[model samples]
Target: MEGNLAAVLADRADTYGWRDRPLFHSGAATYSHGEVHDAGARAAGVLRSVGVRPGHRVLIALPDSIAFVAALLGTLRLGAVAVLTGPELSGREHAYVLGDADPRAVVCGPGLVPRFTSVPVLTGDDLADEPASLPDPVPVPAGAAAYVQYTSGTTGDPKGAVHRHTDPAAYHEAMALGALGMVPGDVSFSLSKACYPYGLGATVFFPMFCGGASVLWPDAPTVRGAVEQARRHRPTLLFTVPTWYARLVSGPEPRAVREAFASLRAAASAGEPLLPSLGDRIEEVLGCPVLDGLGSTEVGHTFVSNTVTRRRRGALGVVLDPYEIAVRGEGGVGYEGRPGEDRAAAAAANAAGLGAGGQAAARIGERGALYVRGPSVMIEYLGKPGRTADALGPDGWLRTGDLVHVDEDGFVHHHGRILDQVTVSGERVLPLEVERILGQHPGVVEVAVIADADADGAGEEAGGGALAAFVVADEVAPPVPVLAEELIGLARERLPEHKVPRSVTFMAELPRTSTGKVRRSALGRAELSRNGDGSLR
Candidate 1:
């Protein structure tokens, strides 16, 4: 409706009297749309009072609370780029990000105050205690950088993806309204903290744009906390990763507990492929179908997703119509990972001519790396043009690094990462494919299948053996022997012999990155500390 994102969103809400409606439901406190924008406007005034200016970056490292949202909205309102980071990020990480972004000011907790002695570090209280009145939103082009969200560092060191003032609105229209069919009556909750890119779209963009309310908590939720929030907030929709879903229904399926989420029509899962068995558990116990999708920081939000209305049982669902996809196979264009060569190959893939609407399909069921180009994708990676070139092409295509196969029904099936492929017993095995089958075992709460990183891809099998599975079993799980048999036996029933794990390790928990993806590379070191019986020493 208007130009700047904050201005436009504020205009829409005010025009509809939505400003008086509840926008954030946090514990017993509710912040109305007008209250949040008022706080945001005051926050902008405070940032401006402290000498912050348009086009400058404001690093915001806070929890999933009203203050974080206020800081983000205020920064955008002032025509500045906001750099988002997890509040729990280590001092070293914070230092690295501060150096990389070189922000004009910071909005963080008190603990970070010592390190930012030279720069202004505004706490939540500062934003809440600003002057009574403030100026209108600063004018900026829709394409101007509005924010920077760093990657989870799974692929490499974190790189900031710069999104535009128009992007969040685009995401809201394409994903929230178009894909999820969210309405003003909907209320949402997410396991991802707002600092995360996926969580940003879920809790911030979706709810705000749709005139729906988001349930906010200061910290990341535990399994109990997740259920509690669901029970209390009664959100109509939920967004999270597969890990939380498995944990929620683990140990036992609580039918009464499922009532906590009875209001939810569906829960969306991204960040990883959702295991079919876990998905079933979610459906049965949570009383909602777990919708699976795939996305990255560069893509801004889930570009390929499954909605409650249109979804398959075990697929990533169809690509959203606003975006176009191409699979890079043997003969297509792709990025070469070099400085200048980063223009094309890694994303567009090794395929022939482009199909209708920028698509280059893989064979009906063959594996190929995915490439996506859309209006919602990032304009560039902030301050990392070389790495950006490697990941994004001149054509606007982003190299997803995700290997997927399109089914005859047009659903996309995840086949692990293009770089994550490993050979076991002379056969190439997709860990995710096998992990999904093994994950179906009742005793398994979580699982990660990996081959030895040291193994030669050409001839020698990984670990000089077949595959291995690192499992976090339920508390009531059987001994390693029985659990191993059940998991391996389950995989054997659905997968080839080579794909079955030759060794099984019982772990209290899988090592994970802050954003919750399994740290697959860290598992490689577990082999070094193993005892004679093959368990971790």
Candidate 2:
């Protein structure tokens, strides 16, 4: 971890000789690297004037703008932790976060000024009124906290993932750009707001690290808005979630959207498992690979991904070497077959032969569960020690609830979540895998899979519930029979016969959380209530 993130940005400005190039662009304006550096300095002066000390928390709720960029750098230059939140956080969530962080000051647009009562508020316009230069970087220790981003919480209270000051620079330099093959000229755009970790990394630091341009559109809720932004800016790369992509592709040809992205070298999807067919369709439509990677807010950025060189339909690619990932089970950490020791013995034992892309099947084995140790892991869950310790072990290996297996070639394949796993006719099934396959159908726009139960605990309610599917389709007619047959066929092809969906339902749309993820628990409960005989309840 570097002492401070500002040093990294400054170093990029010098090394890439991009001091004169545009770093931030919007529909109305553009700011060069030198101008951005100046604005950051000025914003730092405003922070200093406000008595912002090193280690102070400054809640920033500015919309994406030049001032937002400056305020970000300003917070870091002052060695302060910036709480990046969207302007439209719910009043209750906003109040809870403000009280939780107890920031020394809160900066936002005038529209949100009245909501923050605990701390004095500063507007972006006010910062612009002040000189637009920042002080030199303060030396923040490598272990200093940089930001606190909230993550999805099942317990009703939002949880914060505290990132180290240096994690951003390290992640951008060592992992995201270097590992993902991001070059100096790469233009990165993200639909997620900067308050989120994925959006921050993809939009802010990814471009800065490579001396590339970062595109931010103020209007981003609708497909048309995103398409307009893309048409105007023509980003070389896009980082978006599955929901937005589904919406974009489901609409008309989106020809302007496609043409704008004609120069796109790479596209990435996250926030959930993208249907492989959706990925293939995106590649076919946009003429670029829609690489899917996996990460959580706690993990900072994507640690596993489907790279261009070695793309796989449903795999989240190999864990980058910088990260130490192990599939732990009852035995211990599973080891990949090292070269020269077991190849001949395994070959002699298995001549029927699974070759390339196929490997021996195994359960969660003695390794226990998925444990990851790396610089990218969050330091803590703010004030939730019980939850933190339950997930993060003493060895710095975080126990991701996901159960997976690394094949002989060391590629990781995701299984169902431990808590959400189901058994059909004695075979364990991962609902996400089946959902991904269902989402590939031409008519299917989105899908959610859940276990359905009958009330009397008889018939289909044998083991909690049988598998049920909820789907939303594009203009194409609902392929109910075709979908069921194809889904069953896919299950048979990729999984044991028992894991296939017993029934499928068509819906106008699957329910979604505010963040655009399908709410499986909601769907599960709804299905149980809808199908249950009432005995289970």
- Tens digits of per-residue lDDT, candidate 1, 1-537, equal 337888888888988879989999999999998888888888988888887889999999888888899899899999999999988888888888899899999998877777666578898778877664685898997578999998878777888899998877766765687568898889989888888878899898887888889999886678778778888888998888888877777745477568788998878888888888788878988777778988788878887777767889788887775776666676452212211232244334424444434455344456677888877799888888898899898888898999886655556778888777777766667788878787777777788988854334433433345677888887777877777777777888888777877778777678887777888888878354654444566
Model 1 lDDT vs. the true structure?
0.79
What tens digits encode model 2's per-residue C-alpha lDDT throughout 1-537? 477787668777988798988788877688778778777878888988878889898999876777787788888888998887777677877888898888999898888888896677888877765654556889887688888888755435777888887777656743465446887677777887776777889878887777888787655467778777777777888888888888877777757667867878888887777777787778777888887776777888877777766668776665664565766554344432322335445334234333223443223222235667778788998878998898788888787777776555545677656766666544556678778766666777787776655322312336433577777767664445665566557656775555556666666566765455677776656433322211112
Error at 238, model 2, angstroms: 1.0
Best by TM-score: 1
lDDT of each: 0.79, 0.71
Q: How well does candidate 2 match the true structure, expressed as C-alpha RMSD? A: 5.4
At residue 182, give the lDDT of candidate 2: 83
Q: Give me the displacement of residue 293 in model 1, in angstroms.
A: 0.7
What local lDDT score does residue 71 receive in model 2, on the 0 to 100 scale?
A: 82
- Model 2, CA-based lDDT: 0.71
- How much is 210 displaced in model 2, in angstroms? 1.2
